[model samples]
Target: MKKRGWLYFLIFAFILGYTYTALVYNGIWFKFTDGLKTIHFLLYFVWFFVAFFLSLTLHELGHFFAFLFQGIKLRALYITVFVFHKTNKGWRFTIKPKLWVLLGGLVVPDLGEIKSDEDLEKVHKKFANSLVVAPIVTCVFLFIVILTFILSLIYSRSDNWIGFISIFTIYTILLSSLYIYSFTLSNPMFYGDFVAYKKMKEDPVFQLAQISQYTMFSLEDSDETNTYLWEKTRDTLKTIPLKNSIFHIMLLTNYLDGIIRSDQEIDLQIDKKIQHLSISHYMRNEQGLMLAYDLCYYHYKQKNVAKAYQLFDEIQRRVSKKLDPKLTTYYKKKSMHIMHIEYQDEFLEQIDNYYVGNSWIFESLMDPYETLKEYHEKLPFIEYSLPVKFEEETWCFQKSMLYHTKR
Candidate 1:
């Protein structure tokens, strides 16, 4: 069984065992017949859900309002439970959102257009301040609810009003505690807002983030052709130690770009680094897809055509069916490229339009063709680009021969 499947099975078994003990051993099922007890339970259940949702909404609004107060323009606002808004793109619906972004209630701000160092510094400060506002707002509202509950008790209020206050107070406190835990705790499952806020204040982290943004812009920046700035930025990224998955992925992207440019053979050093990333880390969907594509390219270079095809097929199948149109179109183009299928000029034009419209540099960075090679490698690295074309021709010929023999 898959690890995830086994985990689900274990959870199911534990729940079943607990239910059996409660109902059969303890005879707790009889409690359902007690009308007053049942009513109280239902009321608490309803109140809990209502309070929890309200608290989460307020927490997110706190961040949103903070950004507005600081005069920062937000690119997007996402809430895991059916809320998504992007500046130009408007709203989108999807089953799952990025885990870290959803958990942290990340508000992506439009800082890429700010060229001046003074503007960048001001934006970063506001962004950092906004991160803390969610937790603070949650705590403040929780305190107000607790005070109201105390006032109701002091006045010896009617039973219904007392019950209402009591339930709201308990639920607000519980929900607020959960929010606090999510902010303060460091878990491998997802990053917390407090940790990100702290990192944003550090010079190295700030610079790295800025470099990543610029690298993204370079991919879709129409008027800019000189890659000298990109080369320098990449070198700067390399100077930082690969301490986390994000850094490792960024460095791997640099190496992958080198591979596509060189095309002669799989670089052993790059291949080793690709293999070093853990399976769990690769499960981070977007980055995982990029890593999968890199591995597929390596296999194709090694003349392992069947393995390359299989890897591409698996990743294409696993991609979210409800992805944004730009992403869906990009992945389709990628799958075709991996399979060595030629595309019409119109299709390529549409892809270019999508890239420019979406400002999608990360997707562009993963392209295994002349476009990415041109953007990533210059003059001295130009010679490396020849071998990739040769490999693609070789793989296509091999595939044709195999089909003919089978026929």
Candidate 2:
């Protein structure tokens, strides 16, 4: 286990022990028949649950509205229970929610669309404000609750309401403290917003972030050729250390793309680096989908048909389950693309006969070499000299043909 894992385990054990001792001391451990005690317990449980839900909701809204107030357009706002979005057509809501999304809403700004120095500065300011606003709003609301609780104690003649308010106030304050910790504490699984903001303030870090966003946009957009994006990704990875799983996975994606395009040979060193990284700690479901595709491709290339088929089957099973339809479609399309490359003639014949109605199947069947030459003729194909055992392998079949034909 990593240091973070150990720390979390110890904390859990401590909490469990403390809770057990407290329940025993209060004579409430396994005493379900005590009606009065049960009522009090139920009331406090309901109050704390409500307080936590409200606190978390307000905390996320703090970040969401902060971004809007700073003139930043959020692509999506997630509050754990649902994802809210403003699309080109109109607003949309989705029920898919993640724990990280609920703890502090993710504010994805159009950072790649920044075109000027002024725009960059505005974004940096807005990003920083968004990070700080959640904790700030949470603290302010907690203070208000605390003050109200105190006032009720001093001025209220009704003891019952005051007691309930006091407990509610305490729970709210505890929830706020957790909210602050979620963003400030360093964990192997997720970085706090404050930490991310601080890293973004650095020039190299900011440049890498910008480049990553651009790379993703190029990959997902309608543009066919990612030659420029591939080059930018390669150059940026050289300068940035693979300190985090996000960057590491970005590099892996670039590497996988290069291999698929036949622009670079598989590097064992790069593969070794990825193997060493803790991918599960940082990878989301979408990223996992991409990783699965890459692994399927890799296994196929290495002549491990069983493993490749297993991976593909797993992906298909996941698609049949409750995954987002859009995401499932994407994974299926990409997986088919990989299979098309590995089993060119077989896949082509299968698709040609069985999937004639599928537009995506037809699109994926287009000759990659022709597609690359058409969109990116000016860009030179990158050649990597691998170790002696991996000699004679090259990427970009069309680029190689064009080069030799020109010579």
Question: In terms of TM-score, which candidate is strongest?
Answer: 1
Estimate, for each residue in 165-269, the C-alpha lDDT of model 1 and write its tens digit.
667787788878888887877653344668757866775444444444533423134213113323433444446543345545655555555455444334444
Candidate 1: give the clashing pairs.
Answer: 261-384, 261-385, 262-384, 263-388
Worst 10 residues of 1 by lDDT: 376-385
Instruction: Compute each candidate's TM-score over C-alphas.
Output: 0.53, 0.52
Candidate 2 lowest-lDDT run of ten:
356-365
Q: Model 1: what TM-score? A: 0.53
Q: How well is each residue in 313-332 modelled by candidate 2, as lDDT tens digits?
A: 76675533444565555446
